[model samples]
Target: MKDKKKWIIGISACVLLMVSVFFVFNQGKSNEQVVTEYFELLKKKDYKQMYQMLNSKTVYTPTQKYFVEKYKEFYEEIDAKNIQIKILDEQDNVIEYLIYIDTLAGRITYRNKVGVKNEQIQFNKELIMDGYTDGCKIKITTYNPEKRGRILDRNGKVLAEDGKGYSVGLVKGKLNGENDYGQIAQYLETDVETLQKKMSASWINDDSFVPIKTVSEATKNDLINKNILGINGVKISTVSIRTYPYDKVASHIVGYVQNVNAEDLKKHKNEGYNSTSVIGRSGIEAAYEEKLRGITSGKIDLVDKNDKVIKELCHKEVKMSPQDITLTIDIDLQQSLYNEYQNDKSASVALNPKTGEVLALVSTPSYSNNDFVLGLSTDKWNALNNDVNQPLMSRYKQTYTPGSSMKPITAAIGLETKAIDPDKDLVAKDKWQKDSSWGNYYVTTLHAPSPNNLRNAITYSDNVYFARSALNIGKDNLFKYYKNLKIVEKIPFELALNKSQYINKNQKVSDQLIADSGYGQGQILMNPLQLASIYSAFVNNGSIYQPHIVQGQTKTWIKNVFSKETTKTIKEDLINVIVDENGTGHAIYHDHVILAGKTGTAEIKQSQSDTTGTELGWFTIMTTDEKQPILMTTVVEDVKNRGGSGYVVEHTKAPLDLYLSQVSD
Candidate 1:
């Protein structure tokens, strides 16, 4: 009985030992199986299976709120149905997965770096694992459509076109080897690295067959001679570039083009800008960017690895953009005026005194359109931008003190408001002074012993007379007239404006202040264009017309704020300023036409000095014939040699001579 019991115990112990060994080995195998199965599921994009296989302790439990909050933080579009899990690699302890997600635009793949853990994974802690896929990410390639538009003169002369040109493209799958890159770069007279970088930067993984650059005939011949293998990827297409036969003549007005950058893309993305686009940077190019940048056409060409074209998958027919715009400018007159101001630092604006058509607008210190077209280098761009005289600045848009130019407007306001009588005779007496609540500022006549009457005030540009007239008209009335004349604000025109402001004054109109205001002093501001237009109204029987740089546009007429009779009275008085022997503008007078005008010199203050700058000489005039009268205004700022009002008359003679000589026939 003892022996039998011992045998049973031995058997039981052996059975128990065998069971323990089997359980230990089975557990190890089960853990290995679980890891393998989980990785396989992740590779097959079966996230649910992988989640089920995860060790219970390390498994994550997520709430709807957690996902919602995470989605908001990343600005990501997350949908349970569209989430794809792709296992990138599984090594000793770490596993990487690419999670492809569906967005509003298309599929965006993300990378998740996950590690094995024994505890439950927190959703907030795992958020950092979501990152953009680097290796598996799709490389985006951008196509920039060519800018197609016509270059036309104000008269609608086509100077350029969107036509066919030779271009170079890479085959779909071809690598740009050193020899191929060298051959192309040498032909183009560019650096090999630069060419390679540009090619690499422009390469899009999805579409690699498109032309990289448009080359000239000379470059094409050179590439052919080199027997370049990948040269088969090169293509020829019609591209539009600005062409100017007149070159430097109209460069300032026509402007030029440049490559679009990152900032430009942000601002003008909706306006049809892409990665490889060109845009107008200045002149008519900038102003008419929308019109000039026509609709772009696209095509899909299948290319091989060697950049060899296989077939065109799809192509959208190119459509001709909108018709060219017509400008109301006279080309001949523009050339003539430009020629006139070529050597001098001056500007000329000629309008059809009857219709207000800008026949010619010319500013000196102009640049060549070709230089801009060919793509200016950094140094050249800097020189142009940093020029001291600011050649790039349009002088017609610059503002200046109107000086005696404001005299006629002041006189007309005085007479129309009945504040000062037309025939009121008062001696200018050379110097006039008045004390007011604000300390006195002296008003003087340009000529000594000046005539005091309204006629003499304009004729001699007598500050005292205007000052006394300002007192008569009152500050409120002066402001009203200026506003009515569009002097206080910007006038609507195609060109931009530098707005003028009236000097602020005390509530009560003071005698001395009124005097200063009357003489075009105190706080008066006027652009040369404004002064010219106002003078035109003064001489055109009170008919104020909007000044236009474009020709053939309708004349936008402003009602005669002053009646014809009142305008006639003002015109007669103003005639003395040019026709009278001692008149301020007498030097510019001619018997062939009745030239009535005024001369003014405004003092400018310089910085850090008690000394004042030389005067800005001014001349405003009107010429009348059987047809409607023509008006003109000229200004010469900081006259070097001839200072004061004399310089104004001297400069006025040139335009007057040209106008009379050209139009008298």
Candidate 2:
């Protein structure tokens, strides 16, 4: 009896639908108005209102939540905006209409029909997508995976690319028992017994080319020469891998790729990433990941409730070719900087002051990015990770005290705030203190020149002069300058940089600390890029142009942070630092080209009384010659015992001379 009643109800519903179809003849206008209202709601992206107008009693009708979610998801997926709808005609309870919507994929127009029942919309796949049937499945077809994008220099020199490397193989069956496996191990700088144990599996066949290790280019040639039939059984095989052409020269800038790990999979979950995928680990590879990876191309298909062969919904996938990242770096200059500072624990950044493009970035004791891509052994990986010089670290992004390089900036701030009279002399002595506030510490100058003034102080790197200048500027006023210079706010950059800080977190700015910071010591620390940007302000009419690595439009991070007069004053003083015979920066003076610069020696110590401490040498310079208007900031560790800031000055001159001579305006 229950089955009979259910059949009766089903028949009754069919009858009602037929009645409604007939009823639509006279109520066509009303149904058309309701459809128009439904389309209007869609145009406004009012999914809830559109769902409320849907015929709830329709068979296979989804829940209200699902109804709303589907519409929202479809619209969002298409990035639909600026929707327009028009009625075409009316049929037996079905309204034909046209819709034009703007989507992220671009503008699209389509025609479809929706059934109107009792003045409510029959919302289904047809309403969502033109000509697509309800209760259908999308049969997705994936396009073949393409190569990840190449990292290139400004002139398209490959930095990182998809390439191949050779592996050293051992055919166990061909190896004579008395042969010198120890000799091969010695060649690889590895233990012979361990190498033998790993390759000596019982399942080895005669034809098996078991890979012993990936050999370096130098080692691969030696292995190829030694590949004999019976003795060592060493064979070389080429395997595909990501390769860094410039290797350690561009390691910190180009970075490297590695096979996706659990963490990577988890972080990029459901984004078409899997175990076999390789993700960028750092540099441009990491920064422009999605762009380099390219979009997945696929097709959508429509099906019915009973799973029948259906028409294709959409034929083409959203195909995006893997985009190459072109950096603004001049690779030759990058190499030059690397060659100049490779021996020292140093970091350097070169920038086009006129355009704000980062010309090059170099960090010494660099590691080969290729090693990571080809795969690192436990020992090799641990050695790189545990190295004292931090071969794998990116020092360009790390913060170091700007030292006396901060003097010129401090002078700018003081001049801007009217705290210093540029023409008048500062009463800075060889040693001085502010009221001797119960302490044994005093602000001292490295070199004492009679009648110390702004130009003389900068020329001599008079620390006491700048210390008194900071006191005159005061905390509030000094911080005001820092805020304008982007020193307070984080500078927007693709690669992460530790923000330059004036003091430790939550630490109050004491008088002594402020005085020390005035000369780039105390708690003040600066990223190489930030210091380069700050130096750029002098040549940029007192506006700091933001430093960018990727090739693109130049933008100013802050405009007019310093007045033109103030910039001119400081800029001239910097030039004097290089031009004057007595200046600390005169070591880099050239007869043909005038270079504006400042030399800094920042002391690092646990306490004021600590005699055992290290000093970082900093040489920051901008070209005064119009034809070569670039600036660079270089900082090297342990310059205290080796001529202090003079070490950096002497090393940077030749490389920059080469770069300037080769580059045309």
Best by TM-score: 2
Candidate 1 matches the true fold with a TM-score of 0.63
Query: Can you write out model 1's per-residue Cα lDDT over 1-665, one digit (the tens) per residue?
Result: 99999999999999999999998766653323344454455345455544544455443446434433433333321212254566677565455666654432234455555555442221223332233221211112223345456666556765344444454555535553555766655554556676666666654553465555554445457766766444644444545445555655566666677668999977754344677577777766777766676544444333444545444333434353534645555566566656655655555566666777665566666777655654554567899999876677677777777777787788889888888876767654666676554434456564543335677666666777777888888878988988888776777777677887666545454566567778787778888777777766765678867877644565755768777877787778678777888776777778767767777787776531436566677666677663535565556656645656576566556655665666555
Residue 318 in model 1: shift from native, Å?
Answer: 10
Cand. 1 Cα-lDDT = 0.61
| Model 2 C-alpha lDDT per residue in residues 422-500, reported as the tens digit of each score | 7677765988888869278988776866677898888998899889989999999998888777775677887888889
Taking all chains together, each candidate's TM-score versus the true structure is 0.63, 0.76
Q: Which portions of model 2 show Cα errors greater than 4 Å? A: 1-138, 167-219, 226-237, 262-276, 302-309
Off by over 4 Å in 1: 1-240, 244-252, 270-272, 294-320, 343-345, 436-440, 448-451, 504-511, 555-557, 606-610, 626-629, 643-665
